[model samples]
Target chain A: MSVDIKKYLEEKQQLVDGYLEANLPPIGTPPTVLHESIRYSLLAGGKRIRPILTVAAAESIGPPPKALLPVACAFEFIHTYSLIHDDLPAMDNDDFRRGKPTNHKVYGDGMAILAGDGLQTMAFEWCSRVDLVNDIEPYVQVQIIAELAHGSGNQGMVGGQVLDIQAENTKVDFAEIQNIHAHKTGKLIRAAVRAGALLSGANLTQFDQLTAYAEDIGLAFQIADDVLNVTGTREELGKDANTDAERGKQTYPSFYGLKGAKKLAQECADRAISRLSSFDEKADPLRGIAQYIVSRRN
Target chain B: MSVDIKKYLEEKQQLVDGYLEANLPPIGTPPTVLHESIRYSLLAGGKRIRPILTVAAAESIGPPPKALLPVACAFEFIHTYSLIHDDLPAMDNDDFRRGKPTNHKVYGDGMAILAGDGLQTMAFEWCSRVDLVNDIEPYVQVQIIAELAHGSGNQGMVGGQVLDIQAENTKVDFAEIQNIHAHKTGKLIRAAVRAGALLSGANLTQFDQLTAYAEDIGLAFQIADDVLNVTGTREELGKDANTDAERGKQTYPSFYGLKGAKKLAQECADRAISRLSSFDEKADPLRGIAQYIVSRRN
Candidate 1:
């Protein structure tokens, strides 16, 4: 039976939100404005897809462990920090994100930078903290830290951002765009899934299968985003639509056209679902998420 | 017999520079610009005091492990990242650091921001990677990661920077300045020493003694910096003289007169050296560092 994907997402998002709220430094902490600024954007809402992938992937392996929450939330922190830094005046210069002013717009550039920096370090803090996730083997904790760093650092997300920025207003071929997407958004998404599997003690076959599933979905997710920029309304996208083209940024649609991009995205989702076919219905949420990723308006 | 402090520092600095050179992503990497920006600032020479402290602290306990280099370099990454971010136009807007154009001044603000982000994550990567430091126990690695995150994150370095920025051009009490120094710069310094001791397998007693020593020297180091800002020439400071007052930032010298600040620094150095009195001659470098912290012109 198909899962109620919407309800599952909402529930997972709530779980993650609760963890973040309970764990983050209180607003009244010394350096009040720093904590306040961190909360301001971090508490601001999004789909929570990155962290939800972590939870869903872990569930697919087995009943997810208690340690899953902190690891899951770590991905969210990384994602949130990237978003904050990305929207900075020095970077993407976006005024709004998810229907509110970006962190830099609200907190000024300096505090926004520090807020992003704070969140990034906080992610490692959450993952490495023995007190928070005592059930995790020390080796596993170190592995998770390594995974997060590899996915988020220069060779992955940061490097991808550099490619994306350089690609803007330049003639970029398919391979270049692919390189940008693979490293930029795709790696972290893959990391989220891999971390979940690693934490849940997946076997080699299961880890590889999940890795394949994640790769397909990560590409699908990015393609869907590219398509949305062209076809979706501002309200549906939560920010200005077609801004990719406005900025002369290359996307799947820039090469493939809207219909082709949508077709590619659906193909990716199908492949992703197929990769998880060996798993039983315990993975239904993951299957539904793949379907949802390609079809959702936002 | 006294240690040759000058020669010891030069040797340690060279060791750290060699590690950095051999390990960082080559300039020809795919995202060449990001790596270049990271190298531009990271390779720019400094005293490497933080890392040398780590090495010397490890030596004080016993033979330093292979893991010591990575853990030691991690502090420099944190330090250099702080410097890069501090030099951003949005923050301190510093034009130069250590006699050269700052990261933002050369790489532009966006890449400089990403470079800082890269180095920060790289610090975690260096700590977590089992390959780089295989001799270290996984739990010890995790502990080092936790220590670094604690020392550098909001409640420590980042939080201190926020306080420093807020305190600019404002009347501040002695307690406030003390708070700023303890968090902003002091915590990371302490973390450097603690990580060194932890990696070197220092006993609890040795760890406690070294931590006290680190704390004393950290405060002494900050006080010396304040006095230098006021008294040293631009050449000696490698930037500008009286820039602390130029920025309307308060310092130890601002509260206590220069003479009083110098006296306080010496007293801290004395306390720091006293804390290490129980250790044998192996800790001579650490002893020398404490004395050097208060006495150096820059």
Candidate 2:
């Protein structure tokens, strides 16, 4: 019953990468600096997890349209843009990200900010203008845009980031951790999964189950990140180890001890997989992803 | 031949302000600090030129739907978000905007960045989800979104800002000045007019003439801003004046002396009004606005 999660993930990752590189504005576009800056970070490298979830979730229900690839890449752009801005001097202020110089270090701060701004706006362009296929309902397209915006907006990732910054050195309870994680990373992840389901025309029951599955895995993913922050090496994580502690950011490891956090991660993965019993082998990739999120070394 | 430009601008400004206050996330939202920061800058007050242009442009074509109000406010959010980011310590580092403390000055740098980010995302949220009317073509809505995204994105406003920041302390030529102004402020203004015309289903000729009209006035508006920076008092400008030269930002006044710059503005205004000759009284407000942009002291 075990799925070849590694192979499944790799194939999806390549699909998303292909779509992104092919569809992104060419580097020679009039303002070469901006286009270069955007491609510099966007094409740099990452796990491409968010986009893979989109492509996979859509596949889980049925074969998705070609438009799904651009749609998936749009989420990746949002994630990448958030990372670029987060690493700015005014925020997390990190010099490095994913084993490379941060955007600001390479492009200068103003250009870095604009690159992030450009990428964010481009994401919306890709999301709403899926003119390649007319199958997606108009309101559904609007809903997808609204969902992405909500996940990225004040009450979601942005608010979570504000709270995360302000909560440095402040004691946070379990609820606070849940709230931050749910909003910061979880909402976008959930939206990614739900967006795919909706695009594939999932029924209400299937949508509900997938939503639950996404919530469980989203939490598990963040917990693994928190656990890795304490236990993983810098080379393995592609970022500083214990940097979370150094910055006084509250984490699952900080709230629950090492053993407790690990147990929670496993439990979340288990719960996530359990939510897919309604589907047959079609959901194997999503289930495998839930497990991999916790099992990954990084 | 003249309209009550002052009263027209005032009424439109009030419409946008009312929409913003009534629609923005309440201050009591869980992350009240972030919400307060957004409202603080959004409602703090300015001319609301961009949004008024949107509403006015729509009205010029036909009786706009209710969704026009939200769409109009979305531009205001975009404008306000840019201002908030522009005032950040890493950028212009201004302490005050519109005679009050800037976002970062009151909320700290992290909050200000998040507030800007939040508002930017919210702008997208508002741009989408216009479920109120079916008169707008689905593609038209997406086109509106794309236009807004293009205007605000890297190749547009954000790109202009990057150039403006980098050009500080550097000698700039006339072409460079036009490039910056055309992209920075002009594109969005053009989009406002274009968005309205498209929403109201303007013919190709109307669209073309209105686009030219928008371009002329948009450049004129920036030239007016340059002139004001050189001559207006701090009390009238609501922000620092003559600071453009101090920051080494090249301006129209800097390139073409004050008198020459004023003459250029008049030419732009004249060309803008000439484009509206095709329309009857329906376009009087736009005609008046074109005149007002240069005539305005602040």
- Say which candidate scores most in TM-score: 1
Q: What proportion of the true contacts does each candidate reproduce? A: 0.75, 0.70
Residue pairs of candidate 1 with colliding backbone atoms: none
- TM-score (2 decimals) of chain A in model 2: 0.97
Clashes of each: 0, 0
Q: Candidate 2 — what's its lDDT? A: 0.85
Model 2 chain A poorest 10 in a row by lDDT: A130-139
**In model 1, where do residues sit more than 4 Å from their true spots?**
none
Quality of model 1 by C-alpha lDDT = 0.90
Error of 2 at A51 (Å): 0.5
Weakest 10 consecutive residues, lDDT, candidate 1 chain A? A130-139
lDDT (0-100) at residue B244 of candidate 2?
94
Give candidate 2's total backbone clashes.
0
lDDT tens readout by residue for model 2, A58-88:
8889987666877788888889999999999
Docking band of candidate 2: medium
